[model samples]
Target: MKAKIHVSAAILATLCVISFFSITLLVELFGTLDQVAWIKSIIVFPGLFILIPAMAITGATGASLAKHRKGRLIQEKQKRMKIIAANGLLILIPSALVLHYWASLGQFNLAFYTVQVLELTAGFINASLMIMNANKGRKLAHK
Candidate 1:
């Protein structure tokens, strides 16, 4: 039951991260806010909905799993998650706020673009970290 919970949460969180990254990439490729406003709305709605809940689940399940495992890999995964959480708070959250503020004001200027770029970069970094953590979890599971 614990393994299932952990794996399911991790998979869901990973999927949400990937979806967010892909949507951001598509928004960038679409070349302008005006060009992808509808798609942005689509992504934002479900992305926020799923991402937050999935992240919560992932964190809780990961903690539970780690408590049961006294292994180096689990330690590494915990360290990676801590870094990911810190990066999310420091980089991603502020970038998202700036992006939202600028977008709300209909200010798609260089500053808005800069924030968007930063947010996307942070998102990808978090996603990569999550991927590494997931891989470690898988290895631990098989052991």
Candidate 2:
């Protein structure tokens, strides 16, 4: 049951980030400024509410499960989790907040685009890392 919870949480969190990345790209490419603002706000509000809790659950359950494990895969998963957490907290979250604020104010200037790019890049990296970690977890389980 615990393992199931961990896996589900991890996958949910990964999907959430991927969704954010994909939607942001679509909106940025074709949507109007109003659409961008709407997307930005949506990403921050309920999006964060969903993502942060899911990630927390994943991390907590993962740590509990991996506490007694020792191997290369375990080490890699741990390292990846740290990177994901740091990137989300340090880069992605702040970028999302800033972008939302600027976009809401109709400030679609160079800084907003620059930060949008940064957020997308960081989000992609984190999503990839989470997917890799999930693969490693499956391997660990089978072993």
Candidate 3:
């Protein structure tokens, strides 16, 4: 049951990050400024509500499960998750908030784009780390 919760929450959190990345790219490429603002608002509200809790649950369950385990893979997963969490808290969340604020005010200036780029980059980094963790987890499960 703990393992199940860990996997489910991890999947949810990963999907949210991917969704944010994809939507941001699509909107920036084809949508208008107003659309960007709307998307930013959407990303900040329902998106964070879902993502943050899912991540917390994932980490909590992962740590609980790892408590009894002894292996390098488990250590690696924990390390990766720590990095992911830091990236989200230190870079992604603040970037999202700044982007949303700038966009809300119709401030699609250099600063807005700058933060958008930063958010996307951090999101990509987190996504890649999460993928690596998931793959390692699969190997752990198989053994």
lDDT of 3 by residue, 1-143 (tens): 88899999999999999999999999999999999999999999999999999999999988898888998999899899989999999999999888989999999988888888889999999999999999998898888
* Model 3: lDDT of residue 100: 89
Residue 35's lDDT in candidate 2: 93
Query: In what order do the candidates fall by TM-score, top score first?
Result: 2, 3, 1
What local lDDT does model 1 show for residue 63? 92
Each model's RMSD to truth, in Å?
2.0, 0.6, 0.8
Error of 3 at 19 (Å): 0.2
lDDT for model 3, please. 0.93
Winner of 1 and 3 under TM-score: 3
RMSD of 1: 2.0
Q: In model 1, where do residues sit more than 4 Å from their true spots? A: none
Q: After superposition, how far is residue 126 of candidate 3 from its true place, in Å?
A: 0.3
Clashes of each: 0, 0, 0
Q: What is the TM-score of each candidate against the true structure?
A: 0.86, 0.98, 0.97
Using lDDT, rank the candidates from best to worst: 2, 3, 1
Candidate 2 residue lDDT tens string, 43-86: 99999999999999999999999999999999999999999999
Candidate 1 per-residue C-alpha lDDT over 99-128 given as tens digits, one digit per residue, 9 for 90 to 100:
655665678888877877787887888889
Compared with the true structure, model 1 gives a TM-score of 0.86
Estimate candidate 2's alpha-carbon lDDT, on a 0 to 1 scale.
0.95
